[model samples]
Target: MLIQSIIVGLIIAAAVVYGVVTLSRKRSAFSTKPGCGSDCGCNSGGKKLPS
Candidate 1:
């Protein structure tokens, strides 16, 4: 029973870690789009779309 508990604990820890890593990798997408890239006029024309 102790081993099972430990295994469950590790699984939960791993899930938490995975979630943190995924969020960190997507930090860029979480920010504003800077109102279009250098080769476009979509976002720079006026009000930007929902992010």
Candidate 2:
């Protein structure tokens, strides 16, 4: 019974860590403000950079 509980706890901890890592990676992949990350001829609703 004790061994079973330990295994379950480890599985849950691993899942939580994995989810946190994935979320952070996705956040970084998105552009900071939705424009000009790749210079691929895109328009972000006529938004322009500040001079």
Candidate 3:
């Protein structure tokens, strides 16, 4: 019973760490400067949709 509890605790800790890492990676992936991609059409720093 004690071993099982320990194992479960470790699993929960690992899941929490994984969740934190995943969230951080996702946030960084989307944390980019606007108007920096190919979607911009003019010199102004604004996003432009293709017509």
lDDT of 3 by residue, 1-51 (tens): 999999999999999999999999999877755556456644646655666
Q: What C-alpha lDDT values do all the predictions have?
A: 0.75, 0.74, 0.80
TM-score for candidate 1, residues paired by index = 0.55
> Which residue runs does candidate 3 get wrong by more than 4 Å?
33-51
Model 2 quality (TM-score):
0.59
lDDT, candidate 3, at 18: 100
Task: List candidate 1 stretches off by more than 4 Å.
Answer: 29-51
Candidate 2's C-alpha runs over 4 A off are 33-51
| Candidate with maximal lDDT | 3
Ranking by lDDT: 3, 1, 2
TM-scores, one per candidate: 0.55, 0.59, 0.64
Task: Give the top-scoring candidate (TM-score).
Answer: 3
Residue 19 displacement (Å), model 3: 0.3
Q: What lDDT tens digits, residue by residue, belong to model 1 across residues 1-51?
A: 999999999999999999999998799666545666544455566554466
**Residue 50 deviation, candidate 1, in Å?**
19
Worst 10 residues of 2 by lDDT: 33-42
> Tens digit of lDDT per residue, candidate 2, span 8-51?
99999999999999999898876465555343435655455555
Q: After superposition, how far is residue 45 of candidate 1 from its true place, in Å?
A: 18
